[model samples]
Target: MRNETYMWKILAKTEPEKTLYEHTLDVLTVLKEMMKIFPDVPKLINEPNFWDYVFYALFLHDFGKSAKGFQESLRLGKRWGYRHEIISAGFVACLEYESEIKKLIALGIASHHKEIDELKSKYSTHRKNSPGYERYTKALREIEENFGELVEMMKLIPDLSEEFIGKKLTNFKIPNSLDELLDVFSFAVKSYEDSKSSGIDRVVWLKHVFMRGFVLGCDYLASSGNLEIPLLKNEISEIIRFEKFTDVQLKMQSEDMKNKDIILVAPTGYGKTEASLFWVEKNQNDRRTKRVFYILPYTASINDMFKRFVRYFGEDLVGMKHHRAGYFIYQSFRDREYTPDEAKKFANAFVDLSKKIYKQFKIITHFQLLREIFGLPGFEMGISEMAGGIVILDEVHSYDARVIGLLIEALKILKYEFGARISVMSATFPKFLCEVFKRELEIETFITAEEEVLRKISRHKINLINDSILNGVDRIKKFLEDGKRVLVVCNTVKKAQEIYNVLKEFARGESKLIHSRFALIDRERIEKSLKNESVQILVGTQAIEVSLDIDFDVLFTDVAPIDRLVQRFGRVNRRGRLNYADVFIFTGYLDDDLKIYDKELLDRTISELLKVQRINEVDILNLIESVYADGFTQKQSKIFNETRESFLRLRKEIYPMLSNKIADEDLHRLIGSIEIVPSCYENDYLKMRESGNYFEVVKFFMSLAYPQFFKLHRNGQIYQHSHTLFCLAGYDKELGLLVDEFETNILE
Candidate 1:
């Protein structure tokens, strides 16, 4: 017989060999630390015994690991046949709490590892004489044998009364059968599913979501070592210095608009970021901590904003997220002469903390926040983090129709359900999009720069060209020869490359090409190169529309949608330093332009631009309204409506205690892009992979859209190198990927 006074030992993690009891204590400690940071968590839940439910869930979460099979698997380094969360959830029945409270705790424990629906689907069919039942019965016996020691640990919970603990422990019985355990687990599942109903109390949904989200958050943080989740500080006004507030900035800081969602229409140089920060400052206070998410649509923009925020708030308080965040982190650390492994470790740590609840201000790509609504991995924690947060959406006009539809649905939930304060600001926001937000998000505030202020900046004179932009190579040469800084924008990467090739020979200054297809290292180099005064003639595709701060003397470009055209035009004479600059829009384009943009939208954009030769800063809004007057075309409307409906339906299906695995594939498909190594880097990539230097391997990758990926795959120009895809496409530092050269490439 085992000593009754003995403490039963169970493993929570190996390699470092942490015990189950130690892990439990760690998780509870993290919960306490988190509560200290986010003290209003209870108030947000606004439910009685919220802490009690969460505390119980944390302590009992790993109890099932004490089972015999689980212990053996941990000791032998083999996979456990059954999930520990299942048996751990069974303990909820033993606690002498109200049925609803017990179910809430059970739900938190059961769904912490897998979704409640996953558990139900896997074990709901188990009955007498089944293998699953036998497994449960065997595990119960092991737990019952060590029940005394488990009860002794229960006394360690500081919140529970001694008398209550004694009474609960004395009366506790090993579950009579597997049905007792199944019934308790089923109750939790039913409770969660019921909370998803249309008529359920909003508070009930809040409780269920917080319960599930907080447990996982605590568990992950506990396992990740001691990391404090910081709160937004009331110090932005001191850090960001300005000579005087612009009219738009003052309006944003005004008390009258303090509690309302806003649409701020300000031109590129109108201090919109500062205005948004002013708005964030108004919403932030000492009473309660709210997160501030500065969301952008592009990776380059996010990186730029992350650095800017860091300077204002300090590096400890600001975090950024994007697909290439790890790469960016690695680059930053490497610049400090850190070792490869050190940089990699720091990058991993930074990314992990950024994704979790450690930061006060998160500068992120919109997809990072929007992906959570699709129920991507760890979304519960994301939702919990976003509750009562301030979201600043810059460049609201940048996204396509489907993305717009998704953003609308996400805003609805974040506003109504999660209580997020969303501020949508853009230089080129259209009237139709504004109305959409007003109706869907119930926004009441529309702030714009004073008309006089906007009118003072007359920047671009529109030059309509009725021929392919590439056909006017001699005209581009003339601009370069005339000693002017020229910018050429195209609708596609191929077009950019074609124009770059023809003009580089006659270039008067440093000529460079930039697009999305370049590898990370080259892309960053080109982006930085734009800041140099010598880079006078720059050619690019849609990637050049925003996030770049360079000012060019003239712009020659394809005619796109009005919003995009405005963005391109803003790049030239960006600071109003020039009295007037020319933005040449090609009405006729090579076949590729039609494939890149809608024909109908292009026609409307051309019509509006032809009506006025000079595009005044104040008249940009009118230009956008004229082009987008009818809103999305029929095809665009269908895609928008279908995406919105699908996501809203998916939102309903995303109840507490469900698996993210269900939506993982759908999210991946939605991105419809991948990263691959260019043939030029194949040797270097293989060396890194062979030597286990994955941190450096990522730098050689270039992102390829699905269409380009398919074309390369069909031509047998790509091959799988381990898990990394290698493409035989030609690449150059100045011109980027050369798709036309692929026909001559042979893999040696």
Candidate 2:
């Protein structure tokens, strides 16, 4: 009897010898890890009816992999792997559970192999005589027959109300948008139908996809040496282990919570993302509303959040929003359920809002919000409704003054009008904002432990490198030799390229140059590289500062706004490690026009960091305030000062009735006056973007630029641009020609 049970013994062992059980556990591990990145997934699944369904779906996604047909018992059958999911479904149906559970299991197994829409499900029933029908009928019949005995072998389901089930589905389906749920379901059905002739039945639906993805993700994670899934009772140990951060990091986290909206004003290399999440985790998990919106300054940062979110939340839950993050977003709003006319009316708004993201507890990126705000025609109504959410603006200090003013006011509006919980994170927040938050929210979060902050700072070193490009490269070369990683940042793509080219020639060890111009795939490649190395050399645009959290030893940066300079330094020696390298800042002369155009900010920034090579948050912010003491931010300075003053006046004028009692038209009219160009577009720009005859995309953009979104070549238009994400174009006049124009978004 023992010999006969050897297979069971094999399965019982911790080491499963690369069998289906091992693979299943691997899937579970990956999903568990994915949950860390997307910490609020349980909330997403808290829905009444589907939560249990999703739970089991996640549990039994691949229970049937051990079935015979799926094993391909012959050598020749290896390549022609049968639709194991169908076989898997049959096995699941054989389990003694509720019909829904069996169906859910079947769906999870089938959909993972081929998503629903890919199966052409909607058309399956009548689209053909014997085609789609054969697989559907056969698979359904087989599952029913096989699991029939299990259905007789019973277990009672908890009695749930119809209303509760509907409510849960509404919450589950709503955030992902009602339309998305349908599409994903239909996609599953279609994919199943499409594969009919190939010998499969029904494809999976949304619940299954989420479940299987979770299961598969969990399975993948179990294999990782650094990660382990804590048992149910061991969650406390996991939290404690995660919470075992530096005291300084914890203190900064506390300040952010106590203060309404405060910046970290530290260097970049610190664990800010984790720091912020730690803050959120500490606060509360009412689990009713989504709590975080990590508005990364860069899409690359968003991608970092994407990985991090998956690490925290669970990949199945967190959705990355960017113009180009299609894997998790709608492919084309103009297809099937939506029309061109509908696309024009609800086109961009629907596209932006219809993502399956609302179901998620965490969101990443401010650029997506910017795009959704720029709704096209009737699309405006829906997009405007997308507020009342949490917003975390990381690297806020990296923004220019005008942009900063706009972001601050926007947050206040989102807070008052939309019930948003806004958190602006930076190592160099201005006192202006601290007061702004106090005035806006009644409560502000500031971490004021001077000795603690100082302790964190003492572990850091600063160096200024304002020499030519060659000098910066040489300095970086020397830094790299100390076995410390070095990051070189430039103001322009060309400058970054030049430094990268120079570094390529001299650096013997690992070195890489990354910028927005090289295509998005290229940028992601470089970022992935940075994550692995210790003492490597990296030169890029401001992309490295936000989400690219490599434990760098030193940093070198070009001249930038004072707030931005603080953020740049924030990137160096930030993790409270004395072994960290110093930051060498390099400043060059700005043109007279640039200085004049941004006179107050230019003066403030320039005066703040005189040497560039050696400065910290204190030095930079002090210089900024001192430079502004001459009344740069005062009412007397007309253009910008007046703009800042006007922004405040507008907020105060509209602040009182924030209880959803105000009218939408009034809100739009109020927002219309203090204009910041939206980062997203409602135009056919995306469809036009791929028409890629080069000039075709550009011409298409210009032709449609007149009314809906912006007039062609408008200077103030804040485009939601990306390196591999979004881009904006504008006209130039130096040689009477237009050049590639840009706005600050993510790098990748």
Off by over 4 Å in 2: 1-275, 278-291, 327-358, 374-388, 440-443, 459-486, 532-536, 551-556, 570-582, 590-748
- Give the lowest summed-lDDT range of ten residues in model 2: 173-182
TM-score of each: 0.90, 0.49
lDDT of 1 by residue, 1-748 (tens): 1123645476788877888777876787777656655555567667645766777888889888877777888899777677788788888776777788788888888888777777777665236666666665666666665555566566555533222122122323444444455444446666556555554566666777788888998998888975456655556667777889899888877777667788899988888998898888787656436788888988889888888888788877888988888888888899999998899899988888888777888988767877777777667888887877888888888887888888888888788777789999889887888999899998988999888887777899988999989788988889899999999999999888888888888877898898998987788889888889998789998888888888999999988988898888888888878889998888896577877788999999888888897767767888889899998877889988999888866666665566654453366456567778888877777887789866677778887887888898998888886777888878887778887677345343
How many residue pairs clash (N, CA or C atoms closer than 3 angstroms) in each of the candidate models, in the order given? 0, 78
Clashing pairs in 1: none
RMSD of each: 4.2, 16.3
Q: What is the lDDT of candidate 1?
A: 0.78
Clashes of 2: 78
lDDT score for residue 210 of model 1: 82
Local distance difference test scores for all models: 0.78, 0.44
What overall lDDT, based on C-alpha atoms, would model 2 receive against the true structure? 0.44
Kindly report which residue stretches of model 1 are placed more than 4 angstroms away from their true locations once superposed: 1-22, 36-46, 68-82, 116-125, 144-146, 158-207, 660-665, 711-721, 741-748
Which candidate has the top score in TM-score?
1
